[model samples]
Target chain A: MNDVTGMPQTAVVIGGGSDIALATLRLLAKRRLRAVVLLGRSAEALNEAAEQLRGAGVEEVTTEIFDVNDFSHASEVAEETVARLGTVDLVLVAAGFLGDASLEVIDPESVAHMIATNFTGPAAAMTAFSQRLLRQGFGRIVVLSSVAGVRVRRSNFVYGSAKAGLDGFAQGLDDALVKTGLSVMIVRPGFVHSKMTLGLKAAPMSTTPEAVAGAIVKGLESGASVVWAPSSLMWVFGILVHLPRRLWRLVPG
Target chain B: MIPGDTDAFVGWGNNNATRAVHRRPRNTKEIAALLEGSSMCIARGLGRAYGDAAQCAGGTVIDCTGLSEILAFDGSSGVVRVEAGCSLDQLSRYSVSRGWFVPVTPGTAFVTIGGAVAADVHGKNHHREGSIAGYIEELCLVTPDGPRIVGPDRDPELFWATCGGMGLTGVITEVALRLMPIATSYLSVDTDRARDLDACMEMLASGDERYRYSVAWIDAGTRGRALGRAVITRGDHARVEALAGTQRSIPLTYNPVQRLSVPFTPPVSMVNALTLPVFNSLWYHRAPKHRTDEIQTMSAFFYPLDMLRDWNRLYGPRGFTQYQMVVPFGQEHVVRYTIERLQEASCPSTLGVLKRFGAGDPAPLSFPMPGWTLALDIPLGSPSLAVALDDCDRHVAGAGGRVYLAKDGRMRPELMREMYPRIDQFLETCHRTDPDGLFVSDLSRRIGLTPTTPTQRKGMKP
Candidate 1:
């Protein structure tokens, strides 16, 4: 359950190995988070993250093998996890793939994999969790979206489009669950420096994983449906999204 | 018009407003109709509860206030059968003039009879009279299964469950309550000022038994040697002979009206850190050090805050949360520890009240017990308010105490089982009464009161 400050006591991270998810869980542990269940495709990474969370003061930390692409078992895993935890205050969807856009444009197989990892798989998992959460009566879901999805750019249209699909899905889910004691929050970071973007050129307003985690924590406390990493990205995208396509393409990454 | 109107509803605290479909059912037939088709629903009265106990998010909120009719009243026997919507204010206006009053009332009279029953509200007289559950003879409940009458003797399981069930069992349509007979609408009161926590507790423990009603106003701002300094007030219904000069002619007069109201919410809380200490000091110092045999109106003694309509808005747009908890007789130290922790966290509380509760009834979820209960109103603006309250909850639960569900908007689900040891029994009764799980409220869902597994209802489908 979430406390008076809306800080979740127990959380389930779908992509437990994601840098931002681990950082957010660490920060939440400092703010009264007691238990967590980390689910990911890699058993070793999930176990490592669970150990780190336990060390950070989370009383209970468990790991489960989860492959988002296996849509058949998504709902089953959600039910099992909820049964194990008794009540989950939060379910964070932080799984995504940033494929090489240059090669993905021509590689149909890679494109399918990217779309499955970034959009379809996470959506399936969230939908399943939503059913369980609605039945249990109260819980929140936070999905890691991106500013890139706010307006798909020429540089990374494939990854941006996948995130765009997820952003729209989450927004619609939030509205559908209105007054149901269930909510969905979307986090849009301009550019987060993490394992996924280690050698990438830093965007103009790029932020660190810890900053993004801080914003997510604050967003949860404020009951915000959408949060921007630097917060200024809300306005930056307000104008950038409306720019002429020719000019939008010319804007640097 | 099936679901009635769609609007935002909030508890008295004015926080966490949820948009719900509101239905005003005029009779049991209509209520039964609403219950049959709705996936989830809960009855709402005057919304006096400070938290989410009354509001069901995204679900149907049957506004029982429409059923505001006094069906039967035997003035001689001091018993009244009223529609669940009938507010205590209305009941008092009708009954007090006829030498009768509600057996139990919280700080306010605006709450409905059904709400009083649902929360099993207790007044300052709880030390002697117990909660409203003791006075509730029967109730007309409309559940998904259908409408039926329940009482202490008939369907006692369901009756006790509904007492403090937080409206999870079903929608209450009517209540048969036993009122208290009174000679006049005035109280012979006494006041005493205590210098510290021990003195206040000692005075209450030693002298409270002599009075029918007792409560203490603790100054939370005071710390160190002066910590928990309080002004205690104790009283009993004044006899007609105690009335002064002209008042004797019509001693039962009960025309209590709102003297002042907060017209609108201010931009910032009026009861903030800057002004709270000043208010506390003035409130503490203004009281008579020791006074006795003072004739006071019943309204003045019982519901002074009722004189100011929407007084909750004084906390401003962010609103405030009332932390009310009860620890058993031997666990009085938790009361002082809570105040100390609040002060240490710099959480300025505007109002602090202390009362002693007698042995609790059979209701598993009922709040009061043979213990000391303290209630404090803290503005939501305090940064450490949540942590401080959580810390208090841990200690209170460790001491076998529980916070009042009617006043709780924020509490962890894990601690609920620890706080209310019989919560599983209450849930079992809820499941048996409404197996489909049609009745629910935001508070129920937030605290994990709703059934967690589908397996719990496997063999019970009738």
Candidate 2:
């Protein structure tokens, strides 16, 4: 059971509104692990996600109506998550988005604020939660990185750069958690045409939210540090992310 | 040539179907090495089984492949006293040269003799020799209580239980059995083609009594009229004088080359709809139509396909599930119905083996009865795989048929409980010998093969 990564005994998914995050909660519940705490801004979405996870097989899932962006109350949310869940082993940080990528071209302040919400918010939330795991001497976290972070093309540099920062943070947390019996899985999904991608044109190597969710579970179970959507996109991004900035700019949109 | 107590553990033969890499103990004392606060252990033979029949799953598995020294053989009585590790095929080749052979063998001669006795295995000869249980004269078993020799006449209850206890009872170290006298190594085989699944069942059931071994290869992919097209094969050993010039050239002392590991995993599509169709076509065409021919070597006659090593891997990452179920004699229609349903669902199966049983010998949890059983291998693909098979399990149980324990992994405990009525009794013996559940297998955990959970028999009496 110790070898089992992630929070099997109790899990807290911070972005319950995200379908992929809710899917993870549901799967963990189905595995008969108790005390699932869904933390998100929308109480309705958190309650709905918790109910879905319970109905799917998670015998116990509680709702915590709190936003990750509220850094002042992040420690309180972590306490409530562990208090209700009893030894919360996992905290899935799945919040963040590509909110108005073109903003960097016109509004610099709005772009910075967007980056703070998408990257800084989750980083602060995770730091608050990680202390509890460090005290317990064991824990796992699944951080949602994005393919955009792998290569910040000019078309989406504003959103991509935020993910790039978050991705680096998750990797460092993963390295720091080692031998503490704590672990981190940074999932980098390519254009997962989910509810978030409703208006955007589907990217090449695009996959579904379900595929991303399934890959997250597989990666966590296999103790993989990182996972990419469409699976083959790992190699695709591996090469694309290393191209010279000028050469990267030449790639077709 | 062997010591008085040549530890009675079953060894791995050519069948590498177990997780011996997990635990390997040398003797009963050394075998006890894996107990780890557990009271007892079971000797695992060649893991040729399709399911948890060989594994203790969460417990220990002792590799017995090294215990295969054939201790002694009596020429006149055709009795071979061999270590548990010696296989039916090994015994056959060794005995046949001396004008003797193991009386009963499972379809795959790759199975060890200890496995034969433990499972009470039957073959094309089941209708005659009954089973390896009937031919088995004695079993030397080691329990937490220590080594005990049991036979039908010596310890009837323990004897019957150990016959099919799935290694839960104790370690079957050595087996003594009646070996059939053979004039030659070849079989005089005859092939008959059945038009459909129904025809195949009927043809095998009606005429299996006429030959020493009888089985049909079903083309599960066939639909409508061809839904069960099969090639039925039956044969008896060809006498030495009857052997042709070519067959006579094969010497009596020939040893088969052992199979090496699969060097590389082929692409996942190797056994897909397209490839399997071609393979099946080639296989069906290669059979000699209704020809009575003499074949050299039991390996070639009974295990020609064994040459293709790790054939199961051909199913790709979706590890293949082998479903072998036997229904009663009057229920050939039920067998046909099941096949029809599979065809209707368009479930791509790689293989289907159909055979007939003469009569049930009343081995408490014996899988076979007086009827037809069809074993099919389905590679896991869609989510429907489990649901589709659960339906098949219902149909089989409804027909008074049951899935072979050797091939089961994911059967529901409810179905298993209903299928094996004396399950409680089996557990009683398992606890009596292995108090700590040292022989738990993967199949046991999946199929709820252990003691019934409280929820299972909510209101029923214990």
Candidate 3:
């Protein structure tokens, strides 16, 4: 059922992921939607996530190996999720880099591969998810963004630029699904110190993944076309995206 | 409330008197406007009825009586133009004065023309003139789609449906039927005392061939051999010349004093065993043993109760129920067993009538048939009553018979589905006519007549 028009209603979470996507999945299941197919890169990793969902009381889950960079297996994982379960209710594209920004300069190839895995691969995954959502005449595409995308803070423009493109694409798709009751909510988080950003300093009033999950649940309930993380960032970015060129160059990376 | 009828007894299952909201619309256009986007609905006539047939619970009810109007009449052809709301009593008074009468009339004159057509109400002469539908020439029904006139040669399915449609399809607005020509405004009558139930049925059916009107009044409380014993009254419209010289000079006027009701209810026990038995005995004893007499007026012969005002209140707090079921010819055992059970239970019945009908009109849902029909007037308040008769409905169904939709209340949806296989067809027509499901009624809701609501499709559930 992972074809263009249908996706497994079940979803599996790969990696020890953020709580936002899982919280969203649990909400969908409450409405009696079936199948939450979860796929992580490692057997143990997928098992741990499944255990956490079961502990969290999520009723439906499917898991398999799905490494973002492992192209051959990653595509197969998407196929197998649909095969085992059925059409998907939603696709949480919540897997990608909060990698070492400096590693890219030391190894250009790593930077290029990160860009490929971070942007290109997810784009391919989204293409597949979109086909399924449209065919079913319903679906939600939730992709995470970072405040870093607010401006290329040259320090992590590679990640920021990729989010910029993803954010733009998600918004356009949201517009397309207006009357169909389907939508996309690209969440842009401000800097925070997490496992993803181990050494990074927390920004002012920065929120935890718990806060982000709460925000996403509220947004979905309100049938919002889109939602911003730390909601104040919506206005902050509104100013940042149009900052004066001379002042923008002076802002810290 | 009629005797021994539990299904017709509970007009509102939730017997909150606050629920009785009497709506009065001014005219047919208002009714037409109400039909928009109806999910489901049934039309209601006068609340004079003792059952839910004319009382839809929570849906649109077009009070067709608001459209009551006498549009035209051709004295030469005996054809009358009237709104569906025109009452049988009103029509009778108007036409009978001018030498015309309805072809068929139920015991009461308070029923509307549309109600008559909807129930296809038969009369003592049903074995002769058939049901009211036979006299119906054309009907304008506000169908699922909109108002459309249906005649036999027109929308035949709808024509058949509207005759006994019970307002499920839509409100019936105007009707054009041929008024019957009468010899005079009087009836020459004959009364025969029936020895038993069989003799009662025999006397009623056999006398029907000779007389235009025939009915049997059973002494409801009498048991065993006397059970089902009745007085068969048969009559023919009397010409002015047939009346004795002096009696022919009597005036033709509406009775100012008809049924003087029992003022305030006498209490719940008023209609119970002892008193009803006494009353039944008195009624039976009071009838003339075997008399041939001249009846002064057609209304007296046909609609003796038309003179009554607020008669429904006679049933007290829990209104009376009219339990009428057909036990087709061969299944005489059901009728016999039923009467025996009623005898055992000692259910008090005041007015018990027995009549026979010819095969009913083609209106697929019409209730009258070529079988025996017995109706009783029971005072309300009996929980076990419905359960008992529903067993009777089941037995009747098993014997290839059915209860009238126009008089039903407690029937289950499954039974309705089994009995009227064409109900779905009626629903489909409603859907097409009112796509948004604007029309809905209490009876439809009570009987599993539900309309599908819009829900989010598949995933991304909203």
Candidate 4:
């Protein structure tokens, strides 16, 4: 359960191997977070992240195999996680696929995989987790969306469209759970220098994984439904989202 | 069955509000029916609990206020058998004029008898007398197993569990409470101002046994030499000879009035960093250095905060958390450390109360012990507030103390066993009577007192 300050004591990260998710868990561990369950496709990466969290003062760390592309077992995975932990105070959805926009636009197979990883799979997993959280009567779900979803850019339209779907879905999920003990928080980082964005051109107001993790923790404490990393991106995207199509296209990626 | 009114219910702190179906049972049968119909529920009094002890999210909240009826009152024996919904205010008004008073009361008279029992409330005189649990002769608990009349001798395990059980044992339908006899409705109070933490503790430790009731109002905002400056007040019920009046007429008159009320919650807390230090300084300076035998009304001496209705709104819409913990008698340093930590963190506490507690009752979850307790009402806006309070929790638990469950909205579940060593026994008793854990509240869930699995009725969907 979350403590008096609304900081979660027990957390489950779906994309356990994700750099941003691990960073956020580390920060939460420093704030007295006791236990964590890391779920990801790679057993090696999940074990590494779990060891790091243990060293960060988390008393208990467990790893489970989870695949974003395996949509059939989403509900089962969520149920298993809850059954194993007894009570999960927070669930972090940080799985994403930043496929090559130029190549994925032409390759149907890659586009399908990217869409499933970024949108369909995560939405299914969150939906399943939300049911378990509702049964438990109290928990928070934080999904990592991106600024690219604010206005789907032509530069990475395939990835941006998938993020847009996820961003909208998370916002709606938050509203649907109103008055229930469950809440959904959406974190939109402008651009983070992590494994997923390695070698990619740094966007304006780009941030580090640690900075985004800090924002996520702050967002959880403040009970904000949507959090923008670097904070300035909220205003930056606010204006850019409304710009003319011709000017928007001319804006740098 | 009568339909319940669905609404949002918050504790007196006005934070952590949750939606629940509120059923006001007019009689025991109705209460039993409501309990039977709901998968999870808890009894609620006037909602005076500072936290979520009374609220059950996504479940039924049995509003016991409507079941208020004084069934029997023995004037000579001072034993009253009243329905659980009867408030201390109502009972005091009826009994005080008859030369009797409720044995124990919290900081307010608005609390229901049921709540007083559930929280095992202690008063200013706790160092001399124990909590309300000691005054309770018997309880008519309506659990899933049915109504059972339990007392100290009859089903002692269930009896002790029901007391200070946070309504988890069952809905307290009725309580047979032993009222204390009184000569008058007023008290003869002695006030003293202490310069620092050491002086205040010395004064209270040395003088508390001489008086029936004693408490200290601490100035937590002050630092350095002035740190923990306090106003210590000790009193006993004023006798007829002590009442300075015209022929001693109407000596037992007991009419308490609300002089002021906060009408609405402000956008920000009125008791914040800017105003807290000033209030504490003025409150400290306003106290008399040494005054003896000053006649005061019962309300003025005990329930002063009750004078202003909804005073919690002074903390604004964010509400406040009352961090009340008791360290054993020898561990006075924990009390000082707590106050110092709050001051260092800049978490302005509007009201700080320091009291000496006597031996605890048999109830496993009961909060009081032979210790010095400090309760601070801190507004919830400070960013560092959570970490600071967490630090206090560790220190209190380390020193063999525990936070009051009724007043706690946010406490770490892992520390529950460490603070309350008898928690496993308490849970065992609860499960024996309520196998499905029907009586559950947000506080129970937050503190890990309830069963781990989500409760589901036989035919109910999860």
Number of the top DockQ candidate: 4
- Highest TM-score among the candidates is held by which one? 4
**Best-first order by TM-score:** 4, 1, 2, 3
Estimate, for each residue in B313-417, the C-alpha lDDT of model 3 and write its tens digit.
Answer: 555554555667776788766666666566565556675787777777677677887888777666544534544565666777777667766666545445776
- Candidate 2 ranges beyond 4 A from true positions: A1-253, B1-21, B36-43, B52-59, B245-263, B293-296, B316-318, B337-347, B381-384, B450-462
Per-residue lDDT tens digits for candidate 1, residues B408-451, read 98876679999989987888888787887787677876676763
Listed per prediction, chain B TM-scores read 0.97, 0.87, 0.88, 0.97
lDDT of 4: 0.87
DockQ score of each predicted structure, in the order shown: 0.16, 0.08, 0.01, 0.25
- DockQ value for model 3: 0.01
Task: Provide the clashing-pair count of each candidate structure.
Answer: 0, 12, 45, 0
How many backbone clashes can be found in candidate 1? 0
Off by over 4 Å in 3: A1-253, B1-23, B37-41, B246-259, B421-437, B449-462
Name the runs in model 4 displaced over 4 angstroms. Answer: A29-88, A102-136, A151-169, A172-176, A231-251, B1-8, B19-21, B34-38, B244-248, B454-462
Q: Write the residue-wise lDDT of candidate 2 on B412-436 in tens digits.
A: 4467766777777766666666564
Tens digit of lDDT per residue, candidate 1, span A1-253? 5544667768999999999999999998877587798999999889889889989999989999999999999989999998877668899999986877874454888888888899999999999998877755567899999998999998888899999999999999999887666789999998889988988998998999899998998887655789999999999999999999999989775
Alpha carbon lDDT at B178, candidate 3: 91
How large is the C-alpha RMSD of every model relative to the true structure? 5.6, 8.6, 20.5, 4.1
